[model samples]
Target chain A: MTSSFLWTLRSFKHFVNGSSICQAGPVEKRGRGRRPAAQVRGEILDAAGKLLLDEGMGAFTIERVAAEAGASKTTIYKWWASKGALALDGYFHAVESTLAFPDTGDIERDLLTQIRAFARLLTRTRAGRVIAELIGQAQTDEDLAAALLEHYSGPRRQLAVAAMERARERGELAAGVDFEVVVDQLWGACYHRLLLPNLPITEKFATSLVRNVLRGIRA
Target chain B: MTSSFLWTLRSFKHFVNGSSICQAGPVEKRGRGRRPAAQVRGEILDAAGKLLLDEGMGAFTIERVAAEAGASKTTIYKWWASKGALALDGYFHAVESTLAFPDTGDIERDLLTQIRAFARLLTRTRAGRVIAELIGQAQTDEDLAAALLEHYSGPRRQLAVAAMERARERGELAAGVDFEVVVDQLWGACYHRLLLPNLPITEKFATSLVRNVLRGIRA
Candidate 1:
């Protein structure tokens, strides 16, 4: 894979509008061995995510992903710049719904809902394994690291940070609260446990973690 | 490396009394090719740390470590069960000193001190690179993950957790505070940045992070 991920407008817009999410584009041709382009796109992403999560990155290969995806190798190459790039996007696509930030009006409760969903994803799903691999690999993999920041972590944090800022504006949080750190504490704690696993990252732990942060920052 | 790490009393005690801090053990032997066991042991650890930090775990081999440390390959195998085991110990040996918890009586201040020190290590030293590699590799390397929990993250966290508990007892924190979550928010947020550097994890950030958690829990 190349050092930088090629971010198309659709990919970049995922954070702000989630438009990069796979939906069937218009299909004009129905021929032998041909599937809808968007359907194939979604399958390729699923294949990449499952390979990385279930089999680990050591076993990840573009060819294997193509075979599992039932998509032409050309199609995989047509989109992603590199395997690392695909993995970053594929991983985000696989897990983003579980972490979607809710706007429940009450900032504390909204955070709790999201955080608990995250804890469950980490505690119970393959998404946790996928994340562990992505994060673990990011330490040394510069391409993957850069793409993750640009495509995933940066955008994801902004969404949560903006949400908290809204909460602050609504008089639900202290005026001086650094929402970035608040997001860090809330989401980063789940990641710490996911990577470290010294302490359980349970739904119960999620409850207390959110409560403590809210306790610290509530207006 | 084997699945399980061989931890002797000296190794396990490092987290508790830090007696594993390499000292020149009683060694009278100085033959043509022989060195004091303790001195060689100390050198071996330093070499292992340097190898992992500079070259990464992929390049880490007992033979290479022996060549670098001037310790015998047999000596390397005798003490540690696997490469993962050695890397874990070497990493902790390299970093534990910098993360030492200060007992300055004021809970908030002590946290700021340690968190700032950790930020410096992560932000300034090769220690951060070593940690990133260790944590990143831990995703799929089961052996490394287990040993890190047993040797490093678990014991290290206990020391910090106990310190916070003492603060609560002293009426410095609210009785209802979950010190574990408090610890999670403060340290986990830093790790969040370390693994995913969307924001600058500076000493300034450390100061603000500690302030927020203390604001939440301070009695």
Candidate 2:
């Protein structure tokens, strides 16, 4: 996390408590705590994520996360408004590398590859279960829902949407096809299964979702 | 609310405590309590739905529902494995009538109408917020997730799917197209908004989603 990163967090009304999650300026923190806000946020997220994967959401708490991250609870709370926010960010931090959008220059193949990797992240890792917990809890937790839109799902969708926009720019997509809706058709389908449990999330399913989607929207 | 209704409740292992939620059978309850299990279930559900709509899920509780319905917590628990179960059933029971599929012989128009009406139920009523809470809470509660799949979302999807399948049989849909994914694409998009809070659910959005899908999958 950097100053650039703080921009996204700033947009979330519940997040960025008092201008920054950190009560101290970077120089002031260095003078006292020695660790910058970025460093503390990073450590908290890392610990929060590891704990989430190792034990799941039931065991996740601010106090435990603080102890694990070797930071104080005040510091952690300064950055994240609630456990749901932390869990989403932590889970996103943990899985971001594996879920990066691929630019293979072929829209269909790129989407399939990305969706397949995402499907694997959900099925093969604890990421799936953790996300299920975050989403489920977000129903009542307004802060978490806002963080999800601002910090997590919103950014995730932007990445996928950006990838599709690139495809459209390359003339591979039909004119006037709403890329966002196409995204909802593809990744939203995976999330539908994740939240509902009616359908299975698998590489095969991801492939079919992407392929079936392309068959409809391809130029 | 009947024996046939009991069949769906039975499939959920968490539900149907000791072969039935009601301790006494219809005859037994009739002799002693003067209410059949179906009638009791109906009353509980009615009370549950009323509370959920009037006060939302926070005000909803097994004890409260029991008191409101003039039943006992034990009775409510017998039929519902958990509050999640009760909430979903209560919500579905409350909203099922307005969401029925129309058989206008036009698959596209029918889908648009259904999705539009469903969107209205979400936007114009409390169903949207209640469902968001149900889906959010379902993440941690396996029993709720199972109940949602078996009782609510599963049955709801079947109605839309059955309607689409009829469209397929009538030579109105593409033969190889998967109706399930199509459902995911349509309603799932609305659900995506409900859960994520990024998009708004509206009659216009539903119509666009339905029209876009039919453009791809129509025969």
Candidate 3:
């Protein structure tokens, strides 16, 4: 077998091993061999994400994703039940690994660190805009909206709340303070910045927000 | 001339006297009577807002809105420069008259009152979903986004901040507290709740949010 064929065979084996479907390989030679399923899946997701970012969410369609990814429609449908699900998966996966909460044990430091990191990621990435658009689309498209809330918003809010709870346990929060509301306040700033687009979410803003929340909540 | 025509004549005289566009009157009985410009304008705006709420931002078009409103396309073009402009005007005018800052004079009570009122409005109106969708579209559509921020977010933020400042001036807020951050935190909670559909913005949630922020910020 040719080198490209051998490479495709190896990648396919890795995919079957349940590795992430995004591992890149040497470009396949024409007529050399079939592309690996994993490679094809990654291409589709990449194309979908690009289309979402470049053309807005309205441009994301199964046919377009298939054409751009050089994959068959059947291939994509086999993985995702619907186009919105695929779009959500593609959008979520792209940013999933980056969702981190700080645990510096200093409530002020931790909150500021987390907020700034999130702000930077959101403002800097094409994925950020795509996610925002998807959330907006969810308002009208019930299925997409439900999937987003379940897969995206629920987890993120839980994470933030958990962080606040940890701070409360550490006595960083004042007695009788509501952890849920504190989390909302932190998250609300981020959402307002994203949705409003008036103020730049600068480091200063993030730092001040963390400090203010801590000062207000600290026992 | 029919009574409708006479009525149109009287309405046009009234509009001229009031220095407003002569746009309202009964439709010409035989399709040859003068239609008041202001009536046509209001009809167009009403149609545009309805379309935006029902069909998402993409369905907004001069021709479509004119047809839906029973006005001519020429009439629409004469009023607004573009579809985005028309949509913007429709959205702003729909919500503008209802806008107000809570002035209960107590910071916590006022903030909570304002949030509760807004939450009720958002949940009650079809326009709420349309506004959310427009904000999303604005992220990609530069002009729409700019208009939204300038006309909507800017004023809203200003109102919130002003309320906080008033609280500080009245000694309801802790000395040296970062007022801007406090505003961001509160505003962020409401915006996040709107965008993220997982957490229902129930009255309890709104009340709890206010209570927590007040607890955190109170001297």
lDDT of each: 0.72, 0.71, 0.63
Worst lDDT window (10 residues) for model 2 chain B? B1-10
Ordered by DockQ, highest first, the candidates read 1, 3, 2
Q: What residue pairs clash in candidate 2, if any at all?
A: A136-B136, B21-B78
Q: What 10-residue stretch in candidate 1 chain B is worst by lDDT?
A: B1-10
What are the DockQ scores of the candidates, in order?
A: 0.35, 0.29, 0.29
**In model 3, what lDDT does residue B175 have?**
71
**Model 1 interface CAPRI class:** acceptable
Tell me the number of clashing residue pairs for each predicted model: 2, 2, 11
DockQ of 2: 0.29
TM-score of chain A of each: 0.70, 0.69, 0.63
If scored against the real structure, what TM-score would every candidate get?
0.71, 0.68, 0.62
How does chain B score by TM in each prediction? 0.70, 0.70, 0.63
Residue-wise lDDT of candidate 2 within A33-106, one digit each (tens)?
56766777777888888887677766778899888777777776666666666765776678887788889998
On a 0 to 100 scale, what is the lDDT of residue B68 in model 3? Answer: 80
Error of 2 at A126 (Å): 0.7
Q: Which runs in model 3 stand beyond 4 Å of their true positions?
A: A1-94, A174-178, A217-219, B1-94, B174-180, B217-219
